[model samples]
Target: MSDDKDVVIKEYTAPAGGWGSMKGMSKILPKEGISPDVLDALRRQNKPEGVMCVSCAWGKPAKPHIAEFCENGAKATAWELTSHRVTPEFFQKHSVSELAEWPDYDLEQAGRLTHPMKYDAATDKYVAVGWQEAFDAIGAKLKTCDPTKVVLYASGRASLETSFMYSLMARMWGQQNLPDSSNMCHETTSVGMKSAIGSPVATIQLEDYDKCDAIFVFGQNVGTNAPRMLHTLQECRERGVEIVTFNPLRERGWERFASPQSPVQMTVGAPTKISSQYHQVCAGGDISAMLGICKYVIEADDRAQTEGGERILDHHFIAQHTVRFDDFATFCRNARWEEIVDESGLSRNAIEGAARVYMKAERVIAVYGMGITQHRYGIDSLYMILNMLFLRGNIGREGAGPGPVRGHSNVQGQRTVGITEKTELAPVERLKELFEFEPPTEKGWDTVESCREIIAGTAQGFVQLGGNFLRATPEHAAMKEGWAKLPIAVHIATKLNKSHLYPGEESYILPCLGRMEQDMQTGGRQAVSMEDSFSHIYGSVGKATPAAETLLSEPAIIAGIAKALLPDNPNVPWDEWVGDYGLVRTAIENVYPDKFANFNERLFVPGGFWKGNPASHREWQTDSGKAEFNVPRALNASGFAEKEGRFRLVTLRSNDQFNTTIYGYDDRFRGIKGTRMVVMMNRADIAHLGIADGDTVALESDAEDGIERVVEGLRVVEYNIPEGCLGGYYPELNYLIPLEHHALESHVPAGKSVPVRVRI
Candidate 1:
């Protein structure tokens, strides 16, 4: 919120990790005041004996490293295990009006909420309320409203058991309005891959990285996003795998990385080079770049066939396992070279070089992130990548497939366990048969639509499991205004967040246990289950004591509310399920027999059992029963019309933060410090706009969508990004992205790619 432009922006000389990550770890460990015993226990996280890291959804190995946690994971654990607490006295000392002016980091550092509290209108303060009273009030409000007017929102941090129970309870209460965090990020990955290959999740496992001959990473900043994936990339490099990257900026993790676990590298100050070739794709130019590669592959195959040489494409695999190759090839061949070069923002030779690497590899894996999915044509871009992989028979093989790095810890698991607005008919029928309740067949609102409804004053109530929906969502100013229309707002959370501060007419904050706390239920200490990015399900048992004595586990809190709402319903057995999570898994197994059979038994496995993807096993589950090639039209130079000072904005997460949670102000890899409201721009772009390196500026949305979004006081920083493409930290830039500007089919906010005009 400060307009000062004196923020420090230095050059980080070292690569991703040598001593920098170690320094960060050392600084965080002491700040949390973790004892030796607790630190030792946290070190065993993600192992068979320990709980999982409550961070990104990156898959862990069968036998994880001795130090299984990364910098981000350590920060998350430290933040959760902090010794601070937001007691009743703290709430009495600070009013909502006073706390509203505080920053996000300050709000979180105030400590975890220790009790259930209700907002007092006259006093402008939250007063501690008994758990039963809070539940009764919420249930009363829910009972009066039509089911369609209520929205049951969820965060990715919730466990599988809790998500399943909540989904069922929401449906039984007569609604399917489940808007989750996945709807904001990777919904396109699901909708896109389903249309292309009949599968939505990643088709490859962690071990596949070692066996793959080549890897193509598009639009992901692995160093800041999912650092643990770097270990696999290093192993791939040692195996002589060709690594090619497509990004607007040269991410340090993709440039070079030194695993701190290795003594030799740490002592000698040497690191393994990650990407063999880096292609700087323009913001929103991923589809164009992918199409260029596909065109080259098709042309190379044509030349090989005419000369009677070894075919560049797998004709046999294409003929048997895939359909519509002729039409796809024809479209690719007809695409003009000039248009491809212009749209991709790269030379034709560079695109051809990438194609050569793709053709040479016997097996290849294509990994993508939000940069590819958060766009106007995100689905089409994903299909373009799948189309290239199909041309070379890269999928359904030992070490080759499509991989989408999920952003949150259990985002995929939440979706897998029926926490979705558009719940399929099969699952609906199964739930009806098992629970004797008919789930709504009508498609419900997603995150974007739900916000629209709230703004339009149509929604009656809103309840969130964990995420900071107000801060993380696009069009925050409008969202806050919409949130005021809700009659009741409930948050089941561990800590204070920006969303909790924005209360409705009747608001309640019910604090819950963190992932690292022992959930001492009626039976004994209980463990929760989660599915990783690769669909690997395993048990996570916490050994640490609870942060606050009054906090309840997520599942227990959900069951308490459910029991209050359905007081006479005898079919649910809510008490029994909360007492023993195994019963919940049993119910899930009965619901998804084919997907999660023997769900409880699998938890005892050393690592975990795979949920299985049909496409990975060479079985197509599509309407055609084959992987179909989609021929999408080539995109233009820019998705939006260009103005003199307009630039494409790509919202990014800093190295010191996660989704909507700011751990610190610095982005180490980017050499930015003590600031979140800064815009990274190309030197040429800065010069063209007559702006200096640290000039304060305001960014306004370019689209004439009738909504004016202008974020002020963001200092400009010159960086090595592509011209006409600017970068800024997320949640701050989120205000400039319109609610209506989202993916076509999935409706995911295009936060990664937005068009804006900058002014001094």
Candidate 2:
């Protein structure tokens, strides 16, 4: 109830059976047996403690002592702490085929996996076995296949030590397949940033936001996805720093945020003022928007040059520290303004207004998230952002640079510690020099390539460190088929997921310790390092006890596997390193000498440490040791659907959700209550289609191989979104994502751009 004219009051009604009745009931009364304790746990699972809290070990270590968990962190804990248990007895009662029919939530909600289980083809059920026995059996099965047939897939949830050991084992065994979660998320930032600058990380720091005069956030919904960032944005807004947002949907969080931490705002119901100006741009329109900004800057520079005034372009910095400016400038000049306005779904005035703001700001920060990466041209789009930043000598500066807000804690850290398929030349030579073993010089298979190899039956085994690979990847049918084709598949995970259920000829599910669980190694109490989106490296130590004693740390599991594989190597003691994470940190310090100095000492601090990048001071680390500008072409993009009467659909996450997991049914901020079965649309477009507010529609993707997904009887919420754009939650509508539709360089599924025609 703010008196401000910009503040609007909206009323919402809760759906039938309370907020999460349908989802809760679905978990309880599934077509299978349910334990009473499991049911009771599910009923009372919304407590302040449990699995949801355990899973989020990201920024918790750095948080003030009083505040423990965020909303999504609690949801993640609730998800893991569910009372359900899919025991050996339960598995014996049901076949894998039967369990596969159940929804992902129902399958996972069945409960904590108490023992290691292996798929038995004869009984068609997963049978319990001793840990050692399971490991030996897996080892035997792996030995039967060629090392090249095995692919090790890792997730962002894994720690740096675990990832390093996993990579070491894979390399020692001669398998170069390392398909990881980074491929699905921030691979574009990695590839694009490396090409633009020598490093593939954001040069900006969290403290830099305080110094920024203006901020431009593209495609990221900080309110829901990364709530912690909202505090920074709120502080900046309060100080009158100009904030501009570019996204297809005018997300409520970006409009206003009610921080639970603020006593005054919480009591008065005063929400944080979000964007000074919001632009509802079309999907995949980032390139145009960036180019338009550059064009305006160039125009301003020309005016300054002619009038003998202050130059809009940082002429001194650009000349001293950048190359190829003339070529990039020419490309921007040739780009038609009409095309930029039309493609971006922004008016000329809006584009000019944004450009004017960009030109005035001395220190600007452009932050983007998955929405900018999960597209066909994601890498190129990122390059455009770098080009724009380079035009003003923004990169490597105090408050100006490109920031890709990565999801998960260590997605970037995992990549930094040699979890990539394409190993760098320096890392390879360094590994050989350090370990005395010749590392593989050739490029390895990425996620898409690994999946393709699995489908082709060339890859016979898959070993996952963490994550739901099957559910996370595109082409669900092919992903499942690829698993079945494998001779053996091993999943090292904390709990049960759909990916674990995809049985191969031989499959093993090895339960590992969760992030929030105490990890007691030979080092006494071990602390693991994780890198945030802002290139800040920090240590995390779990406060909670282990869910089960049988669970092993990720590093220990990798070391055990490596011990079995490489019985004779002497470069580094795998057992010693596994026992103490500090030993592993020493190795990391040796490998990445430039970034991690005094790695052990620095990690002991509460704030952990920052991986210092001198480039933040405008030191370009590109090929010529200078920031390079990329010139984008105006040729008609090929992947866009040309079908008549079709609009592109962008998949997104709800306030109560994360990737591939639905925490609750209520998207409270979006005015969505009780269910995710709804789509945001432009009111004018919905009326033109003769579709009412509530109607059942089948959305068929324009991609030749894309499947038609039916979101039964969804209520269309008409809002201030761009025309020809639709928004829906992912996984439910993930079926619309085609197997072949992905970004060119990164191969991330084009989850943001799927042309579809809706039919009633």
Candidate 3:
């Protein structure tokens, strides 16, 4: 509507998720060329026998509501089930270079891909090619590839059936470089939780939301990121279950919500208040705030010990279930209030108030997102949180545990199905026995490591199952040229993106059936399974028709490549596996018997099945044979000891977007419109720089590297964020994050808190 295209500065005071969400959902119909039949897709989404919502990894309820999907999930479904097609004719008109010039939103608007295409460098255009011919060409190049030099990147959106085959295919090819989308988002949580408890995923189930006495959310924006979670949060609030939140941005999602699906709430025009305690912690202040809370909890317990009153801490549970509590308590007891207040941008009163709530609650669930996991000390921050949870024995209980808010439907599930590159984490002997292949035991590169290899030109071949590898990782600009110089680059995808344009010597785009589209193979229609963040495995069957006859399921495509590349995977039948996905499940069962027994039978069951977390049952898989408490390197876990003029820059995703895919320019939650090129800053920070709200500014990172990372022409908007912090949309601000700036243990890029300065 605004052809002037200026980012509107008006604050949207309207409640989140009411008529606005319905209007937003309505716009998708025209934009995506969606037919009325998309209703079938929606009706089936998140249902027990239907497709899992591709928008997020939030668990589906056992007894799902009438509308189990959220606004974003609807848009994602419409985008998948769009009638618009990028056929061979469309590719014939636009060259890769020309298409690369288009914006991400425009590229996605081009709609679903309907044919396999190969890049012709002579014309710089992609031309349609037969699936067999494409697979043959790619496999021939892959056969000559160095196992260590090859990069097989999985997007985490692929089904478990595809992921299982993907891992086996990489190992069968003697390739070890298998990096995933998890390496960028929740890898810190995985590393941290796996070290403390025995689980890498959430320790709580969907039903736990109903039973929890209190919920403590850290750094995750529940409304926009996982809007479906808001329904449960609303229910908990109605039940008088307290919810405490710690985040840099006072996101609209947590402030107020009007569930559009509820006719009663809509008619009443009243929104549910979400957070009981909203702490605006500074970016990278998770550890400091948590330490303060721990210190308060410890002192409260000490007072009880002296007064001979009931002890505040779960001492008996601590004594039985955890190790090194004494060390952890002593560490917390020494934390200074002044340091905590300075770093967290909060008061001692606030920290103690939260601690009091924690002490009183018998059952508490601790949930966190990327805001806590994309900092330099991300793992250490989680360690402090885990230590706090252990003090009360939150683990191995019904309504309490640590939950890492994972993006993508199955990012965690990918790792669960043997997609890890770490030698220690890899099932080497088990894979050898099951697949009858000498699986690579040596460690391989992660996202950053793979980028380094690409930049160094050491890695020649790159294959992506379903993500934009270059755009998704940090230092993307630095590796763009290197990625172009590779010998072979292949993408298995449903639509075209900028990643496909970064063609190597030979590049191909293999169109695959989407999660919402029925995947018909030689064995008849197949139902792919996905594991949610709650570690719940459910089968997703696409009820809608396929976009084209040429489109193949991801599992079938993997099998095709396997047939051409590794003709006889002796222990495996490429033909039978694609013909029947159930056999792949059985093979997966064979590999991970204890966890995935009878995967096929349990997959389609109502409410599906939970792959039990070891910590949930108090079965410690650690060396101590019990949960261990981690002592922090220091209470100053952020390491940002208040350098003047440096703002803690947090890279955020717009409500209109998911991962690297830009849905639109507007971020409705934050009142951003007409553009994604805006920065949200506190009023004081804007005044400090002598700039008014909406002033165009330039940002330069202080990563201390010789390279001068900069992004100019950004409009600054005043918001209710912490004073010293600034927020901007990701992929645009991704340039500020350096390759070396990552979580030490997890190696996930430290994107959440990049040190940057703004210039008017």
- Give TM per candidate: 0.98, 0.90, 0.98
Q: What's the count of clashing pairs in each model shown? A: 0, 12, 0
| Candidate number with the higher lDDT (2 or 3) | 3
lDDT of 3 by residue, 1-760 (tens): 2212675767788677888888878877677876756899899889889889888999887788898899899989988888888999998899889998887778877889999999899999999999999989988988888878999999989989999999888888887788999999898988888888877878888899888999888989887889889898999999999999999998888888999988988887589999999999988888888999889988889998999988988888899988999988898888778988988889999988999899989999999999888888898889877888888888789899888778899898899888899877777899888777798878888998899999999997999999888887778678788989999998999888888988989989999999998777788888889888998889988878888988988988998898888858568988898999999999888888887998998988777788887788988888788899887775544555568888889999988888888778778888888888888999888888899987899999886778888899898889988898899988889888888889888889988888888876
For residue 183, what is the lDDT in candidate 3? 92
Model 2 regions more than 4 Å off = 1-65, 81-84, 634-638, 705-719
Candidate 2: residue 178 lDDT (0-100): 84
lDDT of 1 by residue, 272-380 (tens): 9999999999987877788889998888888988999888888999999999999989988998989888888888999999989998999999999998888877788
Q: Candidate 1 — which residues are off by over 4 angstroms? A: 1-6, 636-638
Per-residue lDDT for 1-760 in model 2, tens only?
1112232213333221122323433432432243353343333221222211223223323434244445565455545544455568888888988887766656665666767889998988899888778767877788888887688999888887888878877777776678788898778788878788877888887778879989988888875677656667888999989998998886766787665656676556456678999988888887888788888889889988999998889888789888899998888788888888877778888888998998888898988887788888887778777877777777777888887887876787788788988866238887878888878766788888887787777987889888888888766666777778788888887667788777888898888776655679876877677776766666666545566777788888787667666656888798798789999999999989887889888774554577777567666667888887777653212258445678888888876676766555556566665656667788888898998765656676677553554445455777667788888877767767776788788888888887777867
lDDT of 1 at 162: 97
Off by over 4 Å in 3: 1-6
Question: For model 2, how big is the CA root-mean-square deviation?
Answer: 6.0
